[model samples]
Target: MTPSRPATAPGVREPAGTVTGPVGRLSPTDRFLPLWIVAAMVLGLLLGRAVPGLDEVLSAIEVGGISVPIALGLLIMMYPVLAKVRYDRLGTVAGDRRLLVSSLVLNWLIGPAVMFALAWLLLPDLPEYRTGLIIVGLARCIAMVIIWNDLARGDREAAAVLVALNSLFQVVAFGLLGWFYLEVLPGLLGLERAGADFSTGRIVLNVLVFLGVPLLAGYLTRRTGEKARGRDWYETRFLPRVGPLALYGLLFTIVLLFALQGGKITSQPADVARIAVPLLAYFALMWAGSYALGRAVGLPYDRTATLAFTAAGNNFELAIAVAIGTFGVTSGQALAGVVGPLIEVPVLVALVYVSLWLRRRMTTEGSGRGG
Candidate 1:
């Protein structure tokens, strides 16, 4: 759940909350995001089960291996979130060499490895689901991380820069990493390779269409919006109106996804439950490990929180798009992608409080030591 206000350090409070707070302090829409997502899933399942020929109607038209309706949902879901990133602030974020190098190592390298290990370890029998989880790990986070950082009083500039960097790197790295993890690395480790074979070109096209196009559109929207109207208007007046669309888009996509695979999901409730275990473990391991790393490097609370959240969050939208685009819409991979947010939302919300509590404890202990 992202804040209505842009993710900047603010000293003044509005009449109600805007950019900062713990889980309870979030906006109503954002606060109940998990509810909305759950409701969407239920609705889609009902529609698919009740209505005959609905899936066929929805899939009648296709473009670039994605159904037209689903493709539109993906683009809408991604655009506003990507637009929220401050591409201009990379220099400011990069000046902190420790933060930059640490983020790259965590996001690019460690994040994927841990996810791959957990997915394989947990879901050795479920290749499609395992691949879906691995794709989730590669996505990195450019979306709701701003809200998570702000809630924990993290370095907004660092979140903005890291998110921005992720948006760009995703276009190039997503394909190569997918190839390595799904095919090469698995064979090297004597693990089962992915059941589905994906060509490099297909993965590249999926990324370009889902991430690249929206990234460019987001960059241009921010640049033009600020240049034409001042930053104040862009952030305050324009962004709030546009930001909600991302949620709408996300819900829309989920509905269509479940509609296509409703029977399969309803039949295998145990499968979804099985998927949740590794995801919970993944968040716990990533956050605890990254938070500890931040301290080991001698960073203070704000930068440390940013580092932890960035490492823990994943772009499920891109994962879903990749799964559906590469595999069929009804593939097991898409179902696993759908389950990502369900596990991630509540876990991350709890971790926000953990970060705040840790911050207070650190402050009090530091004061006592000084005295």
Candidate 2:
């Protein structure tokens, strides 16, 4: 079972240590992911430019039109996030109707609408990439929000429930939402429809492959490991070992992506920055909107932080998987999804600090009122 707080064992306090490198030094990857991602991007671009045949070789290593390297990377990226979810705690949120309803509204309704509007407003000339941005907007986060919530001192139980709910909800709602937002809505709005295969079957297949496999793997890993090795060992030892695989896979995927799309990326260097504009705007807007909404609704600081992070984050893994499955691995659409994480990690980390600062301010204000 998942602990109500940061996973700690009785008589064994959780370490307050920063992530250290192999040489016992502070690792840049732990403290600064964007730097590492930029490095990977440069390396990938160099490799692609140096050896033009490499992209072809990787593109050819596909099973049923899906790139094998990307698929494996997606699996690695997703499983650890899923495995950490405490599915058993999902039921506890039944009593907190305000948090549940408010979060769902923020995630499903307002979030997608803002993304669609921003993508259209920002990238009218870049339809394929705009569709990719829309896809990113549609997929509510199930992974990284947990980390953000923890950093912000959010309500852990509420975060767990929301995460589990979002995971199951994504599996069901993502395909239909993708079709509607990326396909039908754009058509209605007089925008050029995405020229990718948003077929229901393809969408479902991607979900099953990307989400289903990892979710099951995560559940099994958690349950079996806990039962065999005991919960304390599983939480402290097993999880710490496995958690970094997701980040490693993410870096690997970024390198492969930049390698394949190096030419396009180089030719239209400005476009990468353009793609990030709406995404950056969306994160800032969503976090502020959700935080204010939570406070207006009388939620305490912890739950408000939970609401804010959940609303702001996106499940870029699912977005990337669908983009690759629908539009080929090297397509502009897939590149948009790739850019999602590059912008997201740094922005969210900054927001975590902001959330902590807000928490302190709120506490101070409340104390003044009492005095």
Candidate 3:
């Protein structure tokens, strides 16, 4: 009589052979992602505008033309996530054709198409905002996919693999997608007036400053951490320690972004209401599409939840940066970028509970195994 292999951890669900654990531990204080973001945004906006010459200061912080605050925020947000990934397991995923193919198809092909349709259906008249939405969609989830995947007790290994692969695709496809949707396709739609000046040189600089540098730093840090702390210590000790710092960085970034845009939001309160519907619809639709696709592929409930969230979540940080850099902060493109987090945080929290409910139902349906 084998003592029933300890129940899968609260957040982890695997096939019959594996052990599970709590996907994530959340306290009452930890539950306020969106609220915190909103607060930071409000404060940041006020500071940026009221302080006078703050933009110059921020611009001065640039390294090789990358805004320091944004770069720091992105690095802090991303490193913990990269640290969690087991680079050793990367090869296994590369070998698994099914996981590789599915993630690629979902992230690049189907996902962008869905976003385009939703943006068009929701804001056909607001071409700039629509284009901004397209940029956000093109970016895809990078850092936060780990959080969502963990929350759903997903196949962590699979998630790690998918994230690494998606990151690659995003760097390549994002610019191309932005060009197609924001530049080329708008002309075809007879919305040439909506075009924002896009700079290939600037985009490349951002990729290097925001993306390339941080990734290298994270990789080096992870390697050093593994060597010094060992695998278990790195996972348990280091990741947990860095998590709060990452959150703080996110909060700071939100504040700065809102500070920059506070007056605009205050002046045009109604724009929030207008954009809210489409953004909400976009989230719901993307999740539904991912869930349906996972089911069709016969993935287990946890994997299904991870896939759904990963597909639905947008990399608004990168999107917002690109929008502002390319189109200026006052442009409709910038407004759309700001609107993303306003919708995303609360919506993602709600989806967390939804996934939990779905998990229970799936377990029951499958007679204690995930369906």
Candidate 4:
């Protein structure tokens, strides 16, 4: 049976032989515009430059004195992340000893150690910017992983499991890693004395709003929608219905963030430039690590991409929250965290293409050997 197509923008058609399934696949536009994440970021820069007073306006416009802008942005970015999972995926993943062990080792054990080293080595001159990289790095494997993994046509089940595991790990590990790397080590390195409030309250609220609330909302929406109108119906009917809403929400958030950072980009061009090497290195190194481990363990190409992408991506959502609270909005540390999406979007898009190439090469070599 031919799958129903979502109405295309003018002059677009389904690719020849394209067949979407019950689990709706990504569209070509979704696949291509990851690079536009960078564009959205630049647009944000322009907003910040042109408005100059946008931040104050955002801050002043608050609900119960809490910043509405930050709150809305967090919700928009996080909801689709949680919505992607089925709880059964989590259970199945737990039983798969290999996936669990690999994820724990990559996310909890190795990722932070290397990130710390790279940040310091690369940005010795600027202590604050260096600390920001560590903050972003340590809070690894968040929403961006899901985006990248989905784009690479990863094993979504494995990706879901990995994301849940990493989110849990981040709560415990983020604080400890922040203290050790940001506070203690930085002191030892002669940067300033590092400090963290470790406001459990704030962290809990962030988890709730960013991770927990959206997760529950996504799950409930899925479950309720499915019950009301069977899985296939919901997949074919509703998800496609709301997909654009989620996509546009994300795009809008990116534009706002970039605009807020607009004025800073020119003045802080060096900041982005300085950390580019380590950020680039981190991406390359993590991709290699995940791929090598995936191959060594004999995972299939799709699963390997999932593993590699999950391990390589950073969870900038929590990182931004922590940075904003720990360092005030204008602080360099916060700026570093803010600059993350600006850098991450473009890099990940390129990485997606690279991952596809790697999969093809590996598959070809395997076939040749078998022949």
Q: Which candidate is the best by lDDT?
A: 1
Model 2 stretches with alpha carbons more than 4 Å out: 1-28
RMSD of each: 2.9, 4.3, 6.1, 5.4
Q: How much lDDT does candidate 2 score?
A: 0.84
Error of 2 at 281 (Å): 0.8
lDDT of 4: 0.68
Residue range 1-371, candidate 4, lDDT tens digits: 01133334457666778643212343554544556666777787777878989878877876633467766765776666556555445677777677778877887767877778888788777777777788778877656576677667678778877887776566566666666776677678776644454344554455455566776787788788888888788666766665555545556665765666666666768877776777778878987898899878878888888888888888776666566555545556666766666566667777777887887788799899999
| Tens digit of per-residue lDDT, candidate 3, span 167-274 | 656666776766676667767877553444566556555555555555566667778988988877877677777767666766666666666667777887887677
Model 1, stretches more than 4 Å misplaced?
5-21
> Best by TM-score, which number?
1
CA lDDT of 125 in candidate 4? 78
Candidates in order have lDDT scores of 0.88, 0.84, 0.68, 0.68
lDDT of 1 at 184: 95
